[model samples]
Target: MKSSRGILCSAVLLIALLAPQCFAEDWLYTVRKGDTIWGLSHKYLKDPLKFQEIQKYNNVKLDRQLPPGVTLKFPMEYLKFAPAEVSVSAINGEAYFVRRGVRATLNKAHKLVLGDILVTNKNSSVALLFADGSELLLGESSELIFDVQTKWGETGMVDSRVRLMQGSAEGRVEHLRGPGANFEVQTPSAVATVRGTEFRVRLDKEDDGIVFNEVNEGTVSVQLHENKESVKEGYGLITSAKLPLAKPKELLAEPKLVNPRSKYLGHPVTLTWQPIDEAKSYQVELFKDKALTTLVHKAQVSSHQVSLPEVNLGEYSLRLRAIDKDGLQGLNTIHHFTISPVPRSPQLKAFDEQYIAGQPLEFSWEESVSATQYRWQLAKDRQFRNIVTQQELKNNTHQLPEGLPAGTYYWRVAAGNIHGFGQYSTLKRFDVKRPKPPELSLSDKTITTEDTLTVDWQAVPLAEQYLWQVSSDETFSNIVSEGKSQTSHLVLEELPESELYIRVAAHGPYNQGRFSETKSVVVEPEGNGKTAFGIGSILLFILIL
Candidate 1:
């Protein structure tokens, strides 16, 4: 009977040792060198004799020594501990996790336990997802500590708390069905508690103790010590560690785009927006695509309108947003616009192939639809090496400043707008015809006692009349005689007793021709009867000798 009782007692003890306690907190520890079961139990449970309980629960034989790297499980009856309720879903750059005074590099799929602090290096970022479907995203140089008050298996309402020690964090909390479910985030100067909402909390690294909270979707109650303020969607609150909570202020509204109106690319774009009453300033951003990922330009202005610099020929997108006095940004208002292709060259209008010199030359061309201005050029050479005249005219028709010299000329025109100049028009040829001068002949080269002299000239093709002039000098500055002729001949009845030079030219309706070659004549005085007798006697005496 005694042996049977001992056997029954041993069976009960074995069963108790093998069965795990449902309510006890458990920890998995790896054994190291110089670490004994008694020392571990004393350090963890504060009782050295509790080592026997660890030995019995692990089914370790008394004669065998604990291995250096063997894993052991310890159940705590008084202290409660649990596995991490959150996991690191994404990590970028360098990040670290600290738990129970042990720090390790944070990586994807790493579990985050309560009271674990996560730190992100410069230009690094981390994202965490909790078992309750809440998410937290940390910006660069940020520190976040998980201080959840609820476990994964808890049934009743509990609090989900996170503390931001430095930098910024954006949170999206899952909706809670129960009454007591709460999600709260605390910074140095402010604490934001919400039922469920999308919000951002930032602790200023420069100011040491300043905090800011912005609600994006739902209401958030921000508390600074004993003072509290409720922030709604599209609003924000700011406070310092020692100051009272400031009143919630309205964020700027999305700007309304006024110009561009779905136009093509290439022209200068005038960006206009409806001004907001509470906005202190505005920002304009231009992107290469609709997604707005590739930024092309960014400008800040106090006015509601801005004219963008010349952009290339392509598709583009523009966005506008307002900034309040406190630097809180409003919702973005986006617009899509494109630059039109370059304008086509203008078509030239029909014009005369020949023009008279010293007459007004009018140039005309067909209007280009997209051209705001037209540029025309007239050159002496086909390659435009010697440009005669060039002008930019607003209208399609332009009058030459003066008639070009008599020569063959090449001309072309191009259309242009704010974007750029288009191709040049096809080259055109024209000529300026000069008037022809007449050929003059004198009836007498020498006039000895003659009272009349007649001058005749050949007829010019386009000449309406002829002009004759006689001068004592070659320059014709002092004219001795001048006359207009209907036909090709002119007669001078009164002769001067000096050398004379005469020339003739033809005249047209528009211009006067060049002068013809000059003809010379000399006039002499007449003699008396006594002088005639003396001259005849001298000639007769010479013949007789």
Candidate 2:
């Protein structure tokens, strides 16, 4: 009696261990005109003897032929299958997968298999490539487990399945090449399957009962508990774990990006869009490359605008979509904008670094490779509230207009391109000074033909020296003689035979002040033997009128 009890206990334990395999997930097979369990087993199954089990499980009599319309269920474990090929196409930031409790970093060279739980860290992403040309993007802060990866033996069929544990995933599934190929994403609350097209699945973070789903180009069948909903292209739905799935509704329309352009100029990048009627919020994502495999930033904004954090200067890509009241994100539209950093405040190389208020004045600064144009401004106030002159130029130099009068002014320049304008250069304060001419007078003008002549004037406050020129023409265009003097007076001994014009100007280190009024100097030979003027002594007269 003891031996019999032990045998029965062992048999029960064995049956318990074999129960899963005996009643695993079913692989439905439809009967054809000439189909039979024995023939199918002979052709596709490893052993023909399993037909009895199939007959017993499906309650069908063992026969050479079965009805054409009858569909039979067979345990999937009994089918011969091969591992479906899956490869890592891209990985940005950090991503990993665990297999058999052993962690492995995800990379192009790493081999992935069934039961690998893929995880992406914050600000990171991973891209997967499947044998059937389907691609999947595991988003940041997401976890996914590979539940099934099988390629049935030479049957032209492949099945790829994953369980989205948290966060979200995006997929671009190729149209199924042959019948029976399947791509599926599972969540705690829902299971979505697609034969071909673009789709997205995310487990709701705030509500454990809700699972969000969207279909962009193809049909997706979402199964929630006992109810199954067919979500066609351009539609989405939020399903509850326990309740039946409602009909899929049209997704929120894509928002028109406000002033969408291919370039972005400066920091704190602001992206805005026209408000959609039913949209409650917006989703914005920024990528470093056009492939969108490298996620740099992402946000869910309640308003129509989203502000991007400061990033390095380079080309980038933006993905924008609208979110409805149910928190179902709509189809996304990718916008390519190059973060063409406004050129760094150009190194200023201004002329004299001083403001010269006059006509035809020029201001020049350094150039930048990214700048297609430059904005130069001259303002009367340091804050540039009162602009005196401004210009947008393709070159680095700007020529001031003719109307500015002498005054203290400020000027600055900034770089720009098709993308936008950069920050203005450092505030520049240049002083435009127009020095006044000095006062001149002839203190000692009395002279004779044979006596030396002396000309005197008041000392200029800022002048370091005085410049006196002797010219025959009143305009002094043809100067005959010129000399510099430290004192207020100049002694002129040698004089030309003809009448001469004299003028003086105050000279300083910065610039020579305006010239004083011209004077007339005349010499006469009192006697025939005495020359008109000589360094030794001559009678010379300077007349001022």
Best model per TM-score: 2
Tens-digit lDDT track of model 1 for 144-207: 8877645422322334778889988877888763433568888888789886787877776688
Could you tell me the TM-score of candidate 2? Answer: 0.56
Q: List the residue pairs that clash in candidate 1.
A: 264-338, 264-339, 264-340, 265-338, 265-339, 265-340, 266-339
lDDT of 2 by residue, 180-262 (tens): 46898988888899888889888787865688899988899998877788999999988887767788989987788888867
List the candidate 2 regions with Cα displacement exceeding 4 Å. 1-80, 153-156, 264-270, 310-314, 340-342, 345-412, 416-545
Q: Model-by-model lDDT, in order?
A: 0.75, 0.77
Candidate 2, RMSD to the unseen true structure = 12.6
Judging by lDDT against the true structure, name the best candidate. 2
Which pairs clash (backbone N, Cα, C closer than 3 Å) in model 2?
Answer: 448-539, 449-539, 450-538, 450-539, 451-538, 451-539
Give the distance in Å from residue 344's predicted Cα in candidate 2 to where it truly belongs: 3.7
